[model samples]
Target: MAQHWIATRPGDLEVFSFEPYDAPAPRSGEVTIEVRAAGMNPADAKHVARGRDEDFPRPIGYEVAGVVTAVGPDTEIGSGTVTVGDEVLAFRISGGWASEVTVAASAVFAKPASLSFAEAANLLLAATTAAEMLHVTGVGEGDTILVHGASGAVGVSVLQQAAMLGARAIGTASGSSFGVVERFGGTPVAYGDGLEQRVRDAAPDGVVAALDCVGTDEAVDVSLATVADRSRIVTIAAPDRAKDEGFIAIAGALPESQAYRDSVRADLVRLAGEGRLVVPVARTFALADAVEATELLMGAHPGGKLALEP
Candidate 1:
């Protein structure tokens, strides 16, 4: 029987047991995958905890790295582009925390041989979002960009991408995560009281643009105060508040362009393959221990991305 994690109500997580339904044969444009590792993000638990009032169970996860098990008829992705045992990373429209999943061929990418299932699983959403924000803001070589909350998965992706683009980057994190920021080639500044002054000192000349991965009032205020162009300042967090504060707001979870997704996947895989990217995995749990994993993910001081192995 295939096992899956499901949430039936707000703040509830349960392992639903079911008989092994025959794996669905892929349709014309679909591919079936045997999931190996599922990456969990904050949005997974938040969406479950704020479930719809009608009381329907919702399957949660969005990114997974697995092996292609089946391919649909009349599709270009025959057993060749991806084969029965070829490893792959997929970005599902919904419901990825399962023993198996069906996805559109477009959302699947060949997993780089250098990345483990765990690292591939963590790449899609966070890396894609960071790449999109950097692209949209026109951050390029020689530009100076500031990233708020520079220690999280998304934040680290931004720091790395900015550096690859030859831009000078300054990232803010708690004192403890400063080393992580620096490792990603960013000047690290401490957040909290006196945050603005800290950032100012780190990038004394001035910041040409800013990206807010943290969504705090301090982050917003500091960016607005330091950047010369508001249009160049973007926030992945606090979208509504960013609009009110006159900064560009982009949603990382829902990327607007398929090309953007492809670009992110390529960049993530390439950097990882070349040992230029570092995806820190703080903890891991078997699929059966998803509840405990989610709890730790929601708690403070759990450093790095968390993954679930199926």
Candidate 2:
């Protein structure tokens, strides 16, 4: 039987047994992947705890990287575009936290050979969210960007992407995590009392844009105070409040366009392949320790991207 982590109900992590069904052959335009590592994100726990659709026994996960074990019939991916045994990374509709997953060909990309399983798994969600924010807000070279919660996985991704685009990035993080932000090519400002003044000191000319990964009222208020164009400020965390405050808001659960996923996947893979991207993974858990992993991820301590290896 293939192993998978299933949350049978809200607020607990339990394993439900499953008989190994034959790996479903992909239909045309689909491909099957043998998952090596699953990226654990906050949304996974939130969905399991909150129960988004009443679909109990839900398999929760969004990003994975592994090898192509099978491809669907009549699909170009089967004919060497993505051959059997090709290493790949995928973003799935569901069931990513599993031993195997079937995804659309368009959704799977070649995993860079240079990346470890954990690093490859870490790329999808945070990197994709950062890419979408940059795209929708039209931030570009020479722009000064202020990023909130700059030490989290999404915050680090945003800092790297902004730097790659030739923009000046000023990131706000707790004093303990300031070094992380600075290592990713961002100017780090402490995020607390006098945050506005700290940001001004970092970017004397003023921040032209802001991306909020932390939903604090303080983050929102300081971003609003610093950026001249409210439309140029976007928030991924506090969508409701962001809307109330007139800043552009985006949610990973509800993105502006489907193509946004494709763009992020492409950019991330290319960057990792070329050694230009950094995926800081602070911890990894074995598949058997999934429950513990979830608990740690939910904790208040500082860490980078965490993954579960199977």
lDDT of 1 by residue, 140-193 (tens): 989988899889999998998888899999898888998989888899988888
lDDT of 2 by residue, 1-310 (tens): 4577777777745533232434467888998888899898888887777774478867778888889888787665411378889998877457777788787887788888899988999887888888888887788999999999889988888888898889989999888998899999999999889999999999999999999988899999998999989989988878888768887888755645456765567767888789888898988888667778878887875379888887
| Best candidate, lDDT | 2
TM-score of each: 0.91, 0.92
The per-prediction CA RMSD against the true structure, in angstroms, equals: 2.6, 2.3
lDDT of each: 0.80, 0.81
- Of candidate 2, the 10-residue stretch with the lowest lDDT total is 14-23
Q: Report the C-alpha displacement of residue 245, candidate 1, in angstroms.
A: 1.7
Q: Report the C-alpha displacement of residue 139, candidate 1, in angstroms.
A: 0.7
Question: In model 1, which residue pairs have backbone atoms overlapping below 3 Å?
Answer: none
Most TM-score-accurate candidate: 2
